[model samples]
Target: MHVTKEQIAGMGKFERANFINSLSGMKSANLIGTKSEHGVTNLALVSSVFHVGANPPLVGMLMRPHTVVRDTLQNIKDSGVYTINHVNEAMVEQAHQCSARYDSDKSEFEATGLEEQYFNDFAAPFVAQSNIKFAVEVREIQVLQLNQTELVIGEIVGVLSNKDYCLEDGYVDIQAAGSIAVSSLDSYHRTERIDRYSYAKPDEPLRSIWKTQS
Candidate 1:
């Protein structure tokens, strides 16, 4: 169906969110981040983990506008730390529960019965049950008021993973990871890798190099 921007802009917030969400389908890992505080401060789920660069291991995520003051965003602003956890098919139900619209005083970890593993100096608690986890310090946050979204950058200071899921060359076997992929918005699916390739030098006259070298 052909739809114009002006026409789509007329839809309600929920409708627009749904439409955009549908367009995105399943996003990356729906991470649960908690604040670094005296006791457990805040817990929330986000679905926006993305890579920015490889040189310094940078990661990014997004925070949407809050119906009420958002503690996760606020806490990240205050404490400058957060955590990220990967979701598996088995935890989808509980992971989905982490998305509930709870008050700032509420903790989704406690609400969903997910255990938080506290570290020696980690500002935020890690999701102990998750096969993969990351402890990050907020590098910068760009607030895009026009879109009502925040682009947060974090320096990956710590990383943890289950050994069995990794390969010798640092490749991850998705089939063993048992992770789900999202498409168009709310849809979820799995990913599989079927091939590998290597490149050849341009000046090397193709097959004449390897055998003729002798």
Candidate 2:
């Protein structure tokens, strides 16, 4: 159970990748959709999506090293637009398949049987089967010097979802949408709504928002 830095570096490539990925615990599972400048669409599953800021509604995602060609990253950079679609229970299989390596000309949407959807003037496509989806415009790309991996930061421009999943307080009910999360690299998980807690304040006892309504 005790793994040292040297031990981690000495581990096999696949083993190290899985171990390092799982160490981050459960992460948001999303399908990143992009389109090449030549109009070829691509879909890829990514779990590294994270919130950067609320005021600007910025989101960040990590991409593997650019030593080799990366279609998704290239498309996003070329088009300056991408879509993040939450991978729900029903689309788990298809979404996971997107992680497989494919030729640059091959579209994961077509390879995995997922439907492509678009809205407004966005240049990227969205997963039609996803219950919750949002489109973003690329703002910046930062490269990690230690590793060649790149970090892409984008600003969310539009979000689409079923009205039933939206709460009075503007919170989207992810559980109602049946969205799923990922553990490690390949495991899929379903989540449940625990309890909604009231905003914390100094010198105040913690309380449940659900209890107040009941």
Candidate 3:
């Protein structure tokens, strides 16, 4: 149970990777959709997507080292637009299959049987089965000096979600949207909201906000 840096380094490659990845616990599972300038669409399953800021509505995700062929990263760089679609429970199998390595000419949408959707003439494709999805425009990309991994930061240009899941105060009930979470690289899980709390004040007791939401 006690694992040190030296111990981790001594572990098998696959074992270390799995252990380190799962240490972060459950992560948002999303399908990043992009299209090459040549019109070849690509879909990649990633768990690294995260919120960068709320005021400017920025989002970010980390791309593995670019030493090998990375179609999604390349397409985003070439086109500057991409779609992030939540992987709902129903689409887990199809979404996970997108992680498979495919040739540049191959479209994961076609290979996985997931329907591609477009909106407002956006160049990137979205997953038709996803209940919640959004389009992003690349704002910046930085290559981390330590590991050569790339950090992609983008602005959310538009969002598409079911109205039923959108709360009065602007909180999107992802659980109600049937979105699933991922652990490590392959495991998938559904989530339930235990309760919601109001913003904490110095000495004030936190109040349950879930009961007050319309």
For residues 32-74, write the lDDT of model 1, one tens digit per residue.
5767465555556566778898679899887775732267778
Q: Which has the better lDDT: candidate 1, or candidate 3? A: 3
Off by over 4 Å in 3: 67-69
What does the lDDT read for residue 193 in candidate 2?
A: 66
| Deviation from native of the Cα of residue 73 in model 1, angstroms | 0.7
Candidate 1 whole-model C-alpha lDDT, 0 to 1: 0.71
- Which candidate number has the best lDDT? 3
Task: Give the Cα lDDT of each candidate.
Answer: 0.71, 0.90, 0.92
Model 3, CA-based lDDT: 0.92
lDDT of 3 by residue, 1-214 (tens): 6889999999999999899999999999999999998899889998999999998999999998552239999999889999999999998999988988888899999999999999998999999999999999999999999998999999999999989999989999999999999999899999988899999999999999997895
TM, every model? 0.81, 0.94, 0.97
Q: Write one digit per residue (lDDT tens) for candidate 2, span 1-214.
A: 7999999999999999899999999999999999998888998889999999998999999998552228999998889999999999998999998998888888899999999998988889999999999999999999999988999999999999998888777778887898898999999999976798889999998788864443
How many clashing residue pairs appear in each of the predictions shown? 11, 0, 0
